[model samples]
Target: MSINCRTRAQRRNQVPLRIVALRFDFETSPQKIEQQLITFLRELRWKARGFDPADLEAAREADDWSDELLACSPSRHDSDKIRRRAQALADRRLRASGMAHLDKDAREKLRGLSDGVRVVQLPSAHRADEIAATLHDEMPWMAQATTLAWHAMRESVRSGAPALHLPPMLLDGPPGIGKSYWARRLAQLIGTPSEMIDAANEPAGFAVAGSQRGWATAQPGRPVELFLRERVGNPIMVIDEIDKVGDVLSNKGVNFALSNALLPLLEPLSAKAWSCPYFRVTFDMRWISWILTSNNRR
Candidate 1:
């Protein structure tokens, strides 16, 4: 990697690293586990009441169900109500089962994000304009991009947004023009955390879109790691030399492409409920600021 980007102030606010250990049930309290078991049993009994397979079979043969089983549900039949309830329970179980790929350590790492990341908001519109002035001086070559950033900041300020969120930007320019550096600088000025990804080095979309659990190298993507590391919801992500990324990277008979993987994250609606392939967890990644720098249009 020829480029190294750094932002002003560089408020990394990086959390201390934690070494994950082996998985063990003893890690949790017996009382808590017992309580969970009790709750599950109670719910299971409630759902099973008057809805046993044997009872249903007998009712089918006799063509006469008990009053409780034949009662009409508000929106449907009693059987329909139980079916919906059972289906809902099954859905929750399936979702939890999908997380089987994650280890205890990985699960713990993601648990911290329950409260969500912090939001960095602009102090005022005037401050945004001032920052824009300073940006023009720092990298005059990126003036047009700077102006776009300025407008985004002004809009954020005017609307009293919780964070200074910017739209996805493509910096089309020749190399050695400080496009990557300027992106980091913008993150600093906006007080949002940032991560830089070299697309030339990425063999798959794991850097941003996340690697699946069954993959040889399975792990969460930068966006998820950013939220965990910086504790910020909206972070500036710079994908340097995106045009240099390969059309596709294949392994274990599975193909992955950075461009194709980014489609969901780039779209606002999909981004709001973006799911990480690593942990099988959904997250709202709408506020992520993307700056894709390219040397050519490829």
Candidate 2:
């Protein structure tokens, strides 16, 4: 084969570098020899052109270090390193996506973008007027709130808007009231996906990156790493029933990790790089459009 044809053929067969999904168990555990076989292609420096060696070396050293630790004790935890790597990958993706310049309109439109993701508009009088006209044939009160939300979102998205940060809205009303319904509709309008994260189930909440034992027992809240990594470029994360977030026993003493986690996100610049105490790596939540819902606070 001539050199040009050979090069063309190789290019056709080459697969792009992508994350090997991490799951801690019999299959993906450090104990499994196959886990190492799937070491990041970039990390192995196996003919990857234009790749950085420092990143490769760091990833290799991380895997090697974890292997050394687990070799001494088969039952000991080695999942933390893997979780950190996954978080790193997530952060890398965020930087790649240009971190879309978020305006109020963009954020409001986010909620309506998809399931488990939606745009939320805050209360506004002008929006109330517009919403009254649009949903005139539908429920009036619900329409009013939805309109206010849209207007607030619209103004918020405008140039030089104030940093109007507030705790997640608690949309409380009668049983048949359309709180969730409006939430879903707002998501649809924004054209983003939405997911309902339950703060009640701490284990499942933290398991998205895989079964790191320490994190499994960690108190429940939105997994900042998973949320930012997996759900970037989306809108409308509806954290449901946050008032019921439970207490978990920890080495530090009984702590409400959920409330603690949300507090930073509520504050501007606070969510920039929240270091997970369990994993010990920082994450960026500045771009996520969070709309939390709950019953009356206790």
Candidate 3:
């Protein structure tokens, strides 16, 4: 009899057998393993109480708005006014697009953007410490920089002011040393979205400060774009390869340099009342965290 059958017969007959060593080999093909893993995941998903479908749909709609807001050049767009109008229009469009079930209060808030100026609510000092710790964990080599930044952020937060002004950071280092990466990671750690501009390729300095409304294809500047997309005044704006920004000569035989365009924006006083060419409105942009990354060591 086969060993398996003998073992079963002995068990059924209530018989005691001599002690013996037994060995068994188990094997699974790659395909079978993959299938088992997939089954396990599906079972887990079925057991978990996942996100509500309505909430998921709302998040998708918000994501779509964010993407669209980031893609357009806001040359002539106004700051709060234009953004409010745009948001109202978007809310209408969303309603027309079968989201009639959206909360009435939310719709009213979008419409209310047109009536009042909204200030960004700064996070607490405790939150800033959490962000700093996360940054240190992500990039241990940047401990000094992160610590200083955290101190600044914490101080700003502790002041209990509605607006928080953060100093602009100019990161000078060689290529591949993670300067740009640090900026991006910092934004993520702070729980804010970031927008990166390649100054080397976009030679038009107007793109940073925005074109005048009289000019064709004029839009709002990069700062306005961040505020509109993220609905916050303090988003991180990263200008990569700032050292390589090129100068362009206009039709009037005037040379426009990127540094010249950035000078006013970088200054705290000037940035406090930065004018938007599109809406022709002055916006307080001191809260924005500007990060300029360059390959130049100097």
Cα RMSD (angstroms) for every candidate in the order listed:
13.3, 17.5, 26.4
lDDT (0-100) at residue 261 of candidate 1? 78
**Order by TM-score, highest first:** 1, 3, 2
Stretches off by above 4 angstroms in model 2 are 1-139, 160-167, 200-231, 250-252, 277-279, 296-298
Every model's TM-score: 0.68, 0.44, 0.58
Query: Distance from true position, residue 103, model 2, in Å?
Result: 36
lDDT of 2 by residue, 42-132 (tens): 2443334443545554544576545533333212134455555555554454344322233334223322322331113323334434544
User: What is candidate 1's CA lDDT for residue 91?
Assistant: 46
- lDDT score of residue 140 within candidate 3: 82
Query: Which candidate ranks first by TM-score, i.e. highest?
Result: 1
- Residue 61, candidate 3: Cα error in Å is 39
Against the hidden true structure, what lDDT does model 1 obtain? 0.69
Candidate 2, residue 224: how far the Cα is off, in Å: 4.7
Question: Which ten residues in a row are the worst by lDDT in model 1?
Answer: 18-27
Task: Compute the lDDT of residue 8 as modeled in candidate 2.
Answer: 17
RMSD to native, candidate 1: 13.3
lDDT of 2: 0.42
| lDDT tens readout by residue for model 1, 1-298 | 1122224232344332221122222224334444444445434443566465435435534645445443312224533554555555544543444444556687678667544556666777888898899999988889999999999989988996666678899999889999999988887777777888888888468888887777787778887887777667777889988888776745575668788777788888999878778777677888788999999684
